[model samples]
Target: CFYLLFNSVLFSVLSDVELRSYRWLQTMIFTVEEINRNPVLLPNLTLGYLATDTCLSEGSTLSAALSIVTGQDKAVTEQCTKAPNVSLFPFFFCAPHLQVSYFASCACLSDRTRYPTFLRTVPSDAFQAQAMARLLRQMGWSWVGVIYGDDAYGKSGVQLLIQELEGSGVCVDYTEVIPKSHALEKIKRIVERIQSSKAQVVVTFAISPDIEVLLKEVVRQNATDRQWIATEAWSTSTHYSAWSGISLVGTLGFALRRVDIQGLGSYLTQLSPEEHTNEQLVQNVWEEVFGCKFGKEMYSGPHCTGLEKVEVQGEAYFDVMYNVYKAVYAIANAIQDIFFFLPTYIKYGQSKKLISGVKFTTPVGELVHFDNNGDPSASYDIINWHMGAEGKVEFVKVGQFDAARGPQQDFQLDLINMENRLYIIQVPVSVCSESCPPGTRKAVQKGKPVCCYDCIPCATGEISNANSRECTKCLERFWSNTDRTECIPMLVEFLSFQDIMGIILSVLSIAGATLTGTVLTAFFYHRDTPLVRGNNSELSFLLLLSLKLCFLCALAFIGRPAPWSCMLRHSLFGISFVVCLACVLSKTVVVLVAFRETLPGSNIMRYFGPAQQRAGIFVCTLVQVLICVLWLVLAPPLPTESAGGELGARVVLLCAVGSVIGFSLVLGYIGLLAAICFLLAFFARKLPDNFNEAKFITFSMLIFCAVWIAFVPAYVSSPGKYTVAVEVFAILASSYGLLLCIFAPKCYIILLKPEKNTKKSMMAK
Candidate 1:
């Protein structure tokens, strides 16, 4: 059996050795020899290989593939009964022959209808594109520029990348294609686009040679501040590593996972020109590594000593060499299966089928097999380029990607101390716009991608998180905090005794009650005096007592409203005012009846005597008591929270009148008694008597009626705690008016003018 190896040998006309490609060629030869020496694998079968140089040209690659199939160019190809071709080139014209490649990673090659016999040891570019899209999203790089080569590999890879970025909030601002001819002016124009782009991150989907030309211009123009994302094609290329000083210091890319093959390193270091004199590629590599000439006649340089050795400098030389080794072993395993288990006389088409089903574990313990698409299991190592000793580039493994894991668990990054190696102190920011913080939401621009947007603050009663698309309104009883990031409970307000307004109203209420007590004491002390007897001291004492009760009832309105307080405050105010008004009405009747009885044998005093006056007061007060009972039983007031009107940020704790009609009737009854008392006192104000008590009763009733009439509008218009304050003020004002108007003149006569309190002053008018 024979293995045909074809690879790009020449990169330019100057014939400089591409060390990385040369290492891949040597890896294939070493694997073929290792398999032949194994005892149990293929006992007596020996494998031979034919190496061909394509000179990195498409025409040359096609010609070399044809020569291997026809067995016309090499003696080894003619002697072999069966040969499997292994190609390192990406693009090829598919034929019926079995072609297994170590480097062809174009996504189009995975189509079984287009290339029926094509298979590869490396993963397709489809998976690499997905990985690239995920990396950009993970890093929050929403805006970026893409540059691809003009070949099938570059075009298909970038097309798949853009498709994977759909709906991910990652946009490609511009895409430039590298020319096939490597023209200087065309490459310069592409560089100009890179420099002018607003995106700080640039991604490339081209092979090493195409990228090398473009980067040369990039370094010449000194455009080195961008963060570069590389594909597997040229991530570890030594060609760029030599020239990548600070220009590509913190470059990030994906590469095939590296595995250490035992004895592979020692075999690579043992290469010399004397041992491989028959191979021209080996002699050329020897001259390049040792800086000497194999033949002094060909070039005027020092001749190689034939003992010069090659030291593997970096893993860049062996990164893709493992792929070449796996391809050779896979073909040998397929042949072993064919001879031992299958029929000896197999067709050429059957050989391709046999290789497709081959599965084996490598020496490094990695399972090697191809799937239905003729591609291996997809996996990659995230590589970061760092400046190493003497300014050389080092490939640091910072993360991993596996296709077999879950979507959320597949891509992982471990970038410990990675920021120290970057050109800047922090990870580069590559977004078109900054992210929206808390309390703000993103407003998308009219004609741009979702990533390009403006940030707007949340409304007054709303809140939002970082990068949120919309603001959420707070609940009814809640309000937004100062930063608007969260919702908090609103401030609850009520007429509490701790407040300044509540304290002032409470003190005034106490003072009025105390003054009423003082007046009641003075009347009791002088009960036998003529002035007190003439005014009917029993009615005077009862009126003063009722006024004191009215003053104390206002205290219930100046505290936190509860179910009991809400019901009691209105009931007490209604009943106390009714009793006080009944006393005033009885006194006014007594004044008019006394004047009529003195004129000429009148019977009015006989009807309105002490017993009759007490009955009249009791009947009037009983009517108010029945109204309060019905009001509390049917629909009484209760404490409730109100958040309407200007109380947007707070909740007002106040009493809600359950039935408006019930409350109106209570106030209406008090007004009816006051109207009767006022009209009777007005008629008796001109009575022929000194110390006319009717005059004081008329003024007190007028003041009481006026204060409550003004309170109606103020109570209805007030909000929150002020509504309770207005009601308390009305109660205090009316109580003080009755106390001062009716008794202030009587107290002055009894204390200051003892002579005027005698019987002579009582009968002066």
Candidate 2:
């Protein structure tokens, strides 16, 4: 005979609480009765039970223990053998000490040496605390506040949670112990510290009743913004069902894996006072469920009609209800195996060990089994409390945290609370500060964590796209694009013949060359005329040819730069302009000397003849040619790419002049020649010759000097291809000025107004 005592009450009770403990008792009873009726399975075995109520008191547990263990209710030496026990005080130790240590184990019944027959359906607090630790680390929450009850279970659970969260990059910011008796001031102070702390996350390991007290205090303080990590002890507890002030909306925690109990719904629906009147199990649940006495005078609400549906109360019997059903079937299966297969098994402990290998699947899909420690294998449903339609509470399945997988995976907190039209973000934020967006990096504030910081924009040529702890320097030879998130290659720019500005300059250069050709043609056609021959026709012809070459040289400065173009662009420009300048100097000298030797047939004018002027022009022009040859040999401009300059993501393709001093010398020598040409032409402007050319030469020298002077600042300020464009523009402007000012007036007289093509019209200035 299995004389079992089922306790209908718990260690404590609260208002509007779900009757989970009572449901566990009824499930065990239903399982025993169902097994006894199955003749084919256990034909000869019949199990019996004597049920009692602890009345939510330690004294009640002691009284129930004495009556079940010994026939004389006070005397307790030992039981006859191992029957069924409801003794919360397992007589193996002192009673009050056992109650104190219930939090450490299971009412201290887990000590196999002292109470080898004690067994429980509920997984102990040890495994739940370990699971809570794993959940915290998975969420990447390192700083947390812990609140615990002073009772045995809460005391031991807090210790275990701290031990588990220790080395996993998690630590407790504060630990508060709730007293066993309701100390209002102590609870209020503990909650104030929690609400005011910098940590946005907190973990609690307290009994259901203590949680209610702490939550009431929390609700009063309006501390609804923290992420609460809960354990199994109070995660599914219904003690806080009516407190609407505290939102508790996005709380994350572990919950027991639920399974559907087969036929339990049918059994609960079939309860009635008319049928099965002798069954005490039926009368006890029926009275409390409908809030009425079975035979009392007053009617509370609904009487035990027993035809009621089970769906109304079925939600309460999920997690712990399934565990109780599995425990009973395991004991039944072990008895069956002992009698039929292992006939020699007589010891109760050996038969209990056989329960380890029992496996079965209930009506629900979850498979039930046990590990060697008699605890269920670690698997928890990660849940979030979501506010649904019409402010209804819903426990949404956000993710899963399994011990079999890696420390952290399979969690998406962003999926919860999405359908609510009020909020676009899925979860309520539980961070000290919003994450820094892209293009900005985090600047850690003083005496604060990396999570709590100020956002600072990335510096020039640097980038940080996402939540960055610090701004990183851009890589060498690479620059941050317009957006700071990425680095790209710099743009290489150069002067080109095809671009808009380059095309206009190139067209001007060509037009200047054409004008010079027209002027030379007119001079050749008028070879015997006084206006053409009076100004030393040989030198005038040479100067006109040099100006044409200078105009054409401006065309070389356009288009994509390369090794060959870079080497010749500036060199050709310098040498051709110098030749034109040398020719101008020769004509200026010829004008002065011819006017000075006009008194008689003097040999002074012989020295300034056409042949002599030609020789001097050749000697002056050859000096520039020698300087260019040495410049090309020593430091020639070559094609090169320089990146990561003032402009970002653009590559500048300017031909890099190999030597700075050589480049300076080239420009400086050109300027020196123009200065000399201007001064000499200015002095000889008033020469007394009818066809004096020094006036036109003076104006052209003034224009040429002005262009190069402007080129210095424009060239230095511009970058990349534009820098080369400035120099090219200077060449075209000066060439065009010389062509327009000096040659245009003569060509107009030679072709358009042939009347003024005489020496009298030329020497009028």
Candidate 3:
């Protein structure tokens, strides 16, 4: 019978030795021992447990625990429906008020899936953040900087602090991101940035590594004049000596600990003799069990061994843990006796549910019964780490608060002044002065008070409204009048000579593109020369058509808004420039290939077979199509409303052909092609060959590519009328390349060699 019971037990509580600090393992061990001794309605059975040494370094111990618990299944069914009891219980002893995510992966929180079963002993992390905010507000610190690790812990803490601060009329002066690895170089950079920010109070969501790096850097840089605050990770025995030794002594830290005596007594009464021993107590427990000495053994960071009030201001941390233990027992008791877990409607009628409501009176106050979410009606302790009269490290419970109330009402307590402590520093409160008056800006800081500063009224072209910090500039259609006192419309008078200049330029660009396209077409169809040969002619014609389109589009882009003008501007401006650029690129590649083929032993020439050349043309055209498609997808066609009504409705929806990256790449590709083409043409020109027209084509493309490349900077930087001027320049430059490259030679032969043309014509007649 003894062997059967022993083997049936899944856990064995061999020795229950509670250190001053009840870590996750110790908490579990204590609970198991208490349950075994009391025989909580179990069918004549007891459990044993074996405790081993584990480090608190990261997730090492959690990984070990998960491995040990694998494949061990001893079913302990509470309800008759037969769910495994061990599996049913997901979690136990959580720091409920500690909502910040720093210790999310610790062994204590290894099983998140079992969260419902996992009971939290303390409040959520939000509770701690809210408490800190209230404390800051009470102290009248309006502006603060936060330096947190770049992880879930730091981010969540920052969010809570931000929420708390914003409501209290405080603004975040700076937010610093510190990596978990705590690289000294990275920390040094962050520290330097923080020092330059001129922040008075620094709140840190850092682990020990981050803290050590930050503190060392702060002290080294003499940036220790400001205050330092910490989160829960430093609330254990590990940080006490190191923190005390550091130049930073008066720094405030936030963590969860059980200091309720009523809860502690209830917990002890329920435990077995082994669990109830001196080892199981808070400070007293550690010295007896481990035979290791600590100066003032405290549960959380800020309490001590003696009742000097100088060391520990309040009750021990045993109280908080004890309250948690009582809550668990109450919940378990209700589930067994009254079967209070049974619901009104059930699949199996009249069967008890796994969970039940719990209510308990804790030492702090009334810890009301929990609802389904396991929300406890409890408050949090605000503790401080300070050096005592004995010159030893100690924690003191300075204040406590309830987070359930409204922002203004929550955590209202007198702050314990720790100005004498080493880590804490007194900082002057910052005031967010009222914004400069509507008509002026902060005028040369006339003195200390904000209202004493001077102000300047808005200029004639600008107007200001209430609640606006600065004046608004007027539109381009109107300008300030001569008086410089008020704005008036810009009077327009019909001008005849200005119109003549615009007409002449428009006609010239159109004539050049049209005559060039016509001449190139005639040469391709009628001439026997190889200059007229090759598939490059089709691409040349496309370039010619795109150039003509640009000329027409520019003409359409004149005057105030019109729908027809808007559509033409977007379609022709974006489409024509792209296609023309593509054609120039194709011509450059052709010239490079021709030179390569002429070279003695160049395999590069072989790569550009007819198929490859055709593929190249297809790729270039496809790139232009993709650019248009991107514009269609990203920039919606729907016209945005304007301040000026119907006249402004017609917005020029010119598609930005490429983003900066795309723009740079396209330009680079064209530049590279042009460079190769010109280099080859230069060498080819040295041979005083007949009709060296390829040289003109090569040099023309080099000039064209350089012009387009330079256009990017000019077009991007140009403002107002200058932008229109640049667009017109681009239109002329792109179209003229085709005229110069394809039609110039034919034009020269026709006009310069007139006698040869006439003689050929007479002979044909």
Candidate 3 residue runs with Cα over 4 Å from true position: 1-118, 207-213, 216-223, 235-238, 241-243, 257-368, 404-408, 416-424, 427-765
- lDDT (Cα, tens digit) per residue for candidate 1, span 530-637: 999988989999989999999999999988888999899999999999999999999998888777675665576788989998999999889989988898999989
**Which residue segments of model 1 deviate by more than 4 Å?**
2-17, 42-99, 106-118, 124-144, 149-193, 196-198, 269-309, 313-317, 337-356, 405-409, 420-426, 434-494, 523-543, 578-636, 639-723, 741-765
Best by lDDT: 1
Model 2: residues with Cα > 4 Å off, grouped in runs: 1-9, 13-182, 186-205, 218-229, 242-252, 260-314, 317-376, 383-399, 406-448, 452-500, 589-616, 619-623, 626-635, 639-652, 682-699, 740-765
lDDT of candidate 2 over 415-501, digit per residue (tens)? 423334222123333455666888898786797544566788888678886767666777765778677888775555556665788
Worst 10 residues of 1 by lDDT: 75-84
List, residue by residue over 538-580, the lDDT tens digit for candidate 3. 6656656766676666664443323444444554566565566
lDDT of 2: 0.64
TM-score of each: 0.78, 0.65, 0.40
Q: Which order, best to worst by TM-score?
A: 1, 2, 3
Checking candidate 1 for backbone clashes, the offending pairs are: none
lDDT of each: 0.81, 0.64, 0.49
